[model samples]
Target: MRLRDLAELVRAPAALSVPGDTVAGAAAGGGPGRSTPGLAAASVCLYWGGMAANDWADREVDARERPRRPIPSGRVRPSHALLTAAGLTAAGVGLAALAGGRRALAVAVPLAGAVWAYDVRAKNTAAGPATMAACRGLDVLLGASGGRMRQAVPAALTVAAHTYTVTVLSRREVEGATPALPLTTLAGTVAVAAAAARKGPGALLAAWYAAGYGLAQARAAADPSPERLRAAVGAGITDLPTLQAALAARAGFPAYATAVALAAPLGRRLARKVSPT
Candidate 1:
């Protein structure tokens, strides 16, 4: 496949928004330190794997609804996408094992399974959002694999809740939505922000994260149209790193928090060229 096609298929720019998943998890589990890089890389690999598998599973529907998607548009073959997913999943698990031994694999293995399951079997069902949220929570738990899983619980739940809200909003990306949904989600975001703010000096970052995420959703709350909802979904995806950073900050890793938070603007800028959703 061509370079641009590969990038599009994997949603490369969006990967920037995912690494913080592990970072936050690790921090919450008891400071990421050296394990951060490997865990983050593993998370990104699984995330890309999920994206590829999603396209492969939804190729037919995408051909009708998203004709320009790599698989639907014929820019990339179905086999290639499936292979990509497999390779990435294996690599992700391997990396997790390398970083944290079997402890990490315990979480990584289930996470990989959840990703594939969501893309192939759950995306259109009532279980879709919950499944996706579970995958995200597992991603966080993967980082805490070799550490205290209990410590990461709060951060994991927060991220999962955000993922749930976003997944719910995504269901109506092409159909538009009622203000009630966005408003409800906005309230949830407030709760997430409040939870994140209780940790440490990281409360400041959480406050900013809340503002950015809330403002984006507020627009959707006001308009509730397909276009607006789509924008809101994109914003929610891009803003994830900021929340991750707040989680990290709460865990007493201000530097890591800053690093993750810094990726948000870049993710947003790149989204202009490549849709994160």
Candidate 2:
């Protein structure tokens, strides 16, 4: 998978660079002495689960337009998906502890487990969008200090941002004619506003970069040209995580925010490569 695609999976909006805004210069890297590898793994597991659910939703289209994928390419076994997803979830927790603090691992693994189960099961029902947003929000919670408003802000943003992305996919599901565009826009607005309102420079940096990141993601998603998508993915690579750390968060926020920013476009690139353009 392309680096952009992996970035997207991480869904770290701040990772991307916007043409005009300054990221607050917050500290870089995870705080010292906090490495809950289990939380990190949970994050990956949760993301893959979301991807799997999305794959299920687009099976037919993928079969037709993109047959080289694991499912369509005859490489994936439907019977094994369940077991694989489960194993990944367990491994995710283990990894999260390795990357995040113990507290992050403790809170994240269980929450991720719950989210993954829902994605595989109940998430397809009417509750799909809600569950999806909640799962993302849960990740922020796991990453945060205490679900305090400062920490909760990212969780709330995840709900809106991811909801918007999913709505874009839903429109694809319906074969055109957008679904919940208004709701998605509104949610995104609230998320942006909320993130902007946070007092510290860190939140502001997150918000500044987030604004551009959201726009770019939406632009990439709405674009119809497969060629254009491919090109844009290439363009997206210009702002990889290292540059993001060195530049975007230059003034106010930490460099890790740059890593977060790298997640979205990179994730998109990876998704396109694996799922098909």
Candidate 3:
């Protein structure tokens, strides 16, 4: 499934921190408006790096344990996996091009590489969560680069809070994992939702996304089949983009459109069930 590879390339893990409004800002045009292009690029670069990281390590674990995955399921190959990851780096660069000339490539590009390193190996090591915390810090710094730096402040803070909360959550709530994944991840979902709501209208959307993540994680953790549990948890991981989109829209921009686009039909189908009536 080339589509699956593409999906995997999206980097669900770091999605929340990508700053949807910033992305919206970049896609609409270049240079200062209400957002920072550098930060958005940083966020994208972080996510892309994370995907490559997953492909390198996490994907392998999934393949060995999760034969249903595209790599193990015969839907994709490692070559494709690697390429999918490489594509993210290119995409980031392309986004950077959209960024008006302000932030230095020297700064953005190396940070991107460091982000990749943290994602692929740093995350799994003891230094991993802390490493990501640093990357998140850097992401906000990137966002603040070369523009109305002040405008990026709120989004950057939001991103930092998210990264810190997650790092804390993973370190505490998710240690020595078991079927408790649902409860732990559900809590995480709720926490992130609350974090998103730090603004306003985003609260409702954040809650909605959190609920989705919770339901999915719950369903996965409670699956009748243990084998399915892993798959379910793996599937639940896909919520990263939805969570990010909710934040972008909250941050005040037209990010919802692109966020929805990134989610695909399946997410929309789920939305009918998840959306408040």
Candidate 4:
């Protein structure tokens, strides 16, 4: 397969939305050292691994529903996708262990398992949303591998809650969805943002992020069509970095939060070229 196909398969642009999981976790866990970047790198690897595994697991289904996807389109082999997922998972776990030792591995192991479980086992089941949310929560905990997990818990839960909302919306991307679903998630967006806004001077930025997220979901709630729901799902994925930024800001790392927030526009631009969903 060509590089473009590989990029699509891994949802390369979406990785932009992932690193802040570590940044936020590290900040929340009391400002980690160099290990933070390494953990962030590991988080990205695992995110890509999960993406590949999703494609691999859904290959047969995609053939019927999403035929243009890389695997279903025959641009990439099924075996290659599986191999890619396995290799990336190993790399992610190894990097976590090297950077933060067994503590990091503690979170990384479960995070990796959650990724595989979501893609290979639980994705189509009723537990899919919760499992995927746990993967994201574990990612935050991985950043706290060297420090206090109690402090990181709130931030992890915030990210996980948003992820749960997104995962729920994603399930209806093709078939459309109920207005109640997006409406409920929109209310959650308000609560999560309000909680983040109490963090620090960067609270304004957090509120801004929440407003944008709420408006996007509100559109879907107002008109729950397949196209609108699809747009909402895309918005959820692309806006994730901003939520992470809010968490970082709440953790008193305004600089890191700002850096993460800046990636939001770039993620949106990239999503235009390659779908983040």
lDDT of 2 at 134: 62
Question: Which wins on lDDT, candidate 2 or candidate 4?
Answer: 4
Instruction: Please give, for residues 99-161, the per-residue lDDT of candidate 4 as tens digits.
Output: 999899989999999999999999999999999999999999998878898899999998898
For residues 78-183, write the lDDT of model 1, one tens digit per residue.
9999999999999999998888888898899999999999999998999999999999999988878767889999899999999998999999988888899999
Best by lDDT: 1
Per-residue lDDT of model 2, residues 1-277, tens digit only: 3454333323323223221111211121123124323344456565565455444444566689756545565555444444455565666666656655575577656666556656556555666656655655555455442223253443334333544344334433323333244335435544543534444544554454445434444554465344433333333232223223332233234545545555545645554444322
Whole-model Cα lDDT per candidate?
0.89, 0.44, 0.51, 0.88
Model 4 alpha-carbon miss at residue 259, Å: 0.8
Query: For residue 109, what is the lDDT in candidate 4?
Result: 94
What TM-score would every model get versus the actual structure? 0.97, 0.58, 0.59, 0.97
For lDDT, candidate 1 versus 3, the one ahead is: 1
Per-residue lDDT over 1-277 for candidate 3, one digit per residue giving the tens place of the 0 to 100 score: 4653445445343343356435423322223343354456545655755565565555666666546555666666677666766676666655654563446344457556766777566766787756665655455445445544455555555444444434533432222345564455556556666766635545655666566556655665565244444333333334444544555565454445345326533544443332210
Candidate 2 wrongly placed segments (more than 4 Å): 1-32, 36-38, 53-68, 97-106, 145-174, 178-194, 197-253, 263-272, 275-277
Checking candidate 4 for backbone clashes, the offending pairs are none
